[model samples]
Target: MRVTIDEDKCCGYAACLSVAEKVFDLAADNIAAVLVEHPQGELADQAREAAAACPTSAIILLDDTE
Candidate 1:
């Protein structure tokens, strides 16, 4: 799966970072960004959780087939 964050929608709440620090990081602009293009196994689960946890729903997970 591919993880992405909509900068315009992100509020820098850092919930995603708290949920999956390995896959999400706060960029210079203080918004969350993807640390990996494709996360595998447990990391993938964490990424999904992070996306769901995002208050603004900024984090998005695009399935490989999508």
Candidate 2:
């Protein structure tokens, strides 16, 4: 899976980081950043969980087909 973050929608809540530290992290500006663009296995699942945990829905997930 592919992961991204909408900077405009991010509130620096860090919920994504909390859910998946290996896949997500806070940037220098405190916004959520994708640590791994293409995560697999357990990391993929964590990325999905992080996306759902995002209160502002800033996290974006895409399938490989796209």
Best by TM-score: 2
Tell me the tens digit of each residue's lDDT in model 1 across 1-66: 988888999988899989899999998889887898699999999998998889999988898987
Candidate 1: pairs in clash: none
Cα lDDT tens digits, model 2, 1-66, are 789899999999988888899998898998888889999999999999988889999999998788
Error of 2 at 20 (Å): 0.2
TM-score of candidate 1 relative to the true fold: 0.93
- Candidate 1 residues lying further than 4 Å off, grouped into runs, are none
What's the C-alpha lDDT at position 21 in model 2? 94
Which whole-number lDDT from 0 to 100 does residue 40 have in model 1? 99
| C-alpha lDDT of all candidate models, in order | 0.89, 0.91
Alpha carbon lDDT at 56, candidate 2:
94
